[model samples]
Target: MTAMPEWMSPPRAEGWYAEDLDHLPEAPRHTELIDGALVFMTSPQRWWHGEVVTALTIALRQQAPEGWLVGREMTIRLDKRNRPEPDLLVTTTAYDPDRTWFAPEDVQLVVEVVSPESAHRDTTVKLRKYADAGIPHYWCIEDQAGAPVVHVYELDVPTGAYAPAGIFREVMKRPVPFEIELDLSTLTP
Candidate 1:
């Protein structure tokens, strides 16, 4: 029988905390904490996913107002036990080379480029979680027939839930989360 590695063992009876992710050097890149458990991105990312994420990051950064930052593959520490990494995020926090994660309050918008394995979590679990944490905006991008389709949502502060803002196919333009327009077709080959 095979034995599990020490780092794979839960460090506490209650399960993994958000801060524990930083201490585990053996953990895989893009490991996420949800409901006190670790979720690893073990599948090879498709080229479509890579291109879309990269292109979106560049587009967002180009239009971002001063003092705002666009980053990719960074986790958001929503609370003690939940830290999910969005594919991209726009933040008010200035550049910090040593930073590993952002607090929910600092995040202005989170974009998840949905892959097959992450579809359920991104569209449902994360949609609820981000809204519950008062993230203000969320964008879930799905590849439709080789083109990027963005589904945007805004936090309904009164209900602590997300309201559908808009969905864009060829182009995405929004005033909140800063005024910006993206030609979605350009995100991939």
Candidate 2:
């Protein structure tokens, strides 16, 4: 009998570390590996979240410095056993075009447009993970309110917590260097 390569091994029902993801024959829709566990996402309840994401992307493009990438729906490898697809990500242009996904090291900012089902996970689980991985920025957009609200978190290296940047008013863009000048109302549903 021949031994199979690690990637070819059968996947465990839960607790999916990064190594296990390498063997996934193909990308499974709406699944992210968190702390070695497979977390599935429900489809968006409405298109408002997506529209906000698009607005943010466009705003970033207009204001971000050269050599920075404002990307949407990119899979970032946060650790050996975890990957989460954020709605938006900003990073320096050093990304590897040949690689199938961006590793944690390649990430600079991660943004999540919260769905009704995703609010808890986004604020707690995902927030902690991003902080642990030392990701510089994390943004959570909540549209449940009549007007969309965005929560910005910046990593504090020594303490490792994602502290809020501030309460942004009508227009909330990504901070300078990343280009954050947009009318917040446009992003609201």
List where candidate 1 sits over 4 angstroms from the true fold.
none
lDDT of 1 by residue, 1-189 (tens): 899888999888999999999999999899999989999987899999999999989999899999999999999999999999999999999899999999999999999999999999999999999999999999999989998999999999999999999989998889998999999999998
The residue-by-residue lDDT of candidate 2 on 1-189, one tens digit each, is 988566534366555666555567654565677777766665644678778888888877777787888888766788777787788888885756655567666778888988877878888988998888888888887874556677888888889888888656676756543646768887755
Query: Cα miss at 42, model 2 (Å)?
Result: 2.4
RMSD of each: 0.8, 5.1
Please count the clashing residue pairs in each candidate, in the order shown.
0, 9
The pairs that clash in candidate 2 are: 15-36, 16-36, 17-81, 18-80, 18-81, 170-184, 171-184, 173-180, 174-180
